[model samples]
Target: MESEMIVIHAENAPMPGISKPGPHQRYRHPVISVEKRRLGALHADEIRVQMIYAGLCGTDVHLMESDPQTGYIRSSAPANIPETGRVIGHEGIGKVLAVGKNVRHLSEGAVVTFESIIVCHYCDVCRKGQFNQCRNAKLLGLEKDGIFGKVVDVPAMLAHDVTPIIQTDQDLQAIACVEPAGVAYVACRNTRVTGGDVVVIFGGGPIGVFAAMLCKTIFGASSVSIVEPVSFRRSFAAQWADHVYDVEAFFANMPECIDVVIEASGDLQNINRIFRNVNANGRIALLARSGTSLVLDAMDHMITNAISIIGSRGHLCGAFNDIISLYKQGRLPLHQVVTHILDGTDGFMRLVGAIDSVLYENCKVLIRFASANGRS
Candidate 1:
């Protein structure tokens, strides 16, 4: 049955008449329109989903404000806006309404969430169980259609049945956040944050906050400190971090006692300073994505101290299940990360406004679909 659905489409071209901004400033906001479009047919391995809630991610914002001249987004990978534009969202949860004949795991009326990366199982990396690094992976919302609309067709393999763990509306909300939370989980897991470790996170954004929370509540870190320049973010992170410091205050009171460092902020100026703060044999995990070249002057410090630096990319397949398990156990308070929930009926302008206010006013913003209240 063909039906019309509302979708948020990101335009490939820049917004008319807006000049590009200086570095670190917002670029010409990409042209996004909320319009009704006909739904496509479901493939044999796909399932039809009715989106309930979708989280706004940093990648989405980068794609929306892509470089005007190149039309490229600076994120985990460099991607140019497709000529036909694209649907712009990845983190979300929904209810399954129909399953294709080839689908076996999920069923109708099942609540579910999805992994953003669609990997080819035949790839060499996938054969070795490193599906996250699959050579031919396609990122949803960027390389293909995303789940920003009221209804979407998702590959059954990429959808996880989260119905068992969702006991409340809040649980449903937290499940929508599993994607970003998984990124933080992988960072902390790779760094091996354990008991007695004094960890420090360089950014207090959603990822940094999640890392800090895991360090203290899940990973057993003795002390977790967060450094952020935004006062609102610092205040928000104080609940999870043992201490929160503004960039100036953090440098002024620099202590060489950290056992692990997680760089969630893409600010390159702190590269050298991070080496100085860690104790000997400390581990550092880089979680942020940046297009600019990073310059460091603390090579000697890193070598002499035996510090290991690790670069973490996207989350693995297991991360989503692990996060869902944690949430089921009540160990993860993922709901706290959501600061704003805008109704989709407000349209594209409201979403753009919410994105603009993120730097100062919001932590995690969600768009609730108008049909969310009526489930199959």
Candidate 2:
């Protein structure tokens, strides 16, 4: 028997008495609606997944705020409202509810984590194995419906099997973080971290912490440090980074001849600070998506120091597989970064309303859609 599904579509509607000078406009509420529909058959290469846990990201908070500078929210709608009103989330781990006839590697009831971006294999970048920079990329949450809802239809290739890493449902929940971990891995790859090098990460957010973990655990950095402003995040970062410093404290005793620097804060001031600290020929990887711009000191940093500034975007989807393998080997401690888990739909709304405030204190927040016994 076919199951029933609810498909929420957002219509074009602007708030009253609000006009924006820039391209971004403030929307008072989250743009989501629930509509009734029957579960449709999957495409030959697609799979139907029932979401178990969806992680709330900083990007979601920016979307809720209608932050004019955030990438996904600013581009969410032509004006202020979304066209599809699709469920809003990009990071999740789910169980395969059904698989299409042509789906070869996956089976119903199998647990998986999906890569949020579905790239066109025909693109030049994708052909060269740089799918992260694919010319034509269709994002799951932004360009299409996301995985926040009960069930989602995803390309079978985008879903990676997590059975190897997941020992219990709790481990499956941690898989919701594989996306950010992959992004951090890409940033570390950009910096070309080597053993015994000193690495510094700016910001104490989930990405910042995960980048620090990869630098220490995978790249074998001699020392990993974090520069964060918030006391709560600074304390949380201590578990992963060897040294956690408040911004002022870090600047006071800033290390010299740093091997690699990762700027994940999205704060423009970090660039200048990087210039002062990074050694000649050291690599600095910019990993933030905050729609902010920066002006670099060319003479002192670029020409004289010969510092290489690498702009890193999303991860190669295949990187998720590597992350899962590492997690299975007990190298990636994703669960350590999960600070809170809110259960059910009401919990989801509560997060949407208070996410901006929570970002200062929490590392990663997961919304548990299913109970421990697998009931929703």
TM-score leader:
1
Residues 1-376 of candidate 1: C-alpha lDDT, one tens digit per residue: 5432333333344445648622223223356766555666779899998888888888777655655565544453434345455666788899998999999899999989988888999988999998878899888886777888778888888899998887777887899999989999999988999999999899998899999988999999998999998889999889999999999898888666889889988886776766777898999888787755567788888899899888877777599989889988989999999988877636445767556677677788887873445442
TM-score of each: 0.89, 0.87
Worst 10 residues of 2 by lDDT: 1-10
lDDT of each: 0.79, 0.75
lDDT string, candidate 2, 224-340, tens digits: 999999899999899888899998898888788788989888786777766767877889888776655677765556677788889887867467878888888888878888888
TM-score (C-alpha, index-matched) for candidate 2: 0.87
User: How far does residue 89 in candidate 2 sit from its true spot (Å)?
Assistant: 1.1
Provide the lDDT at 199 for model 2. 90
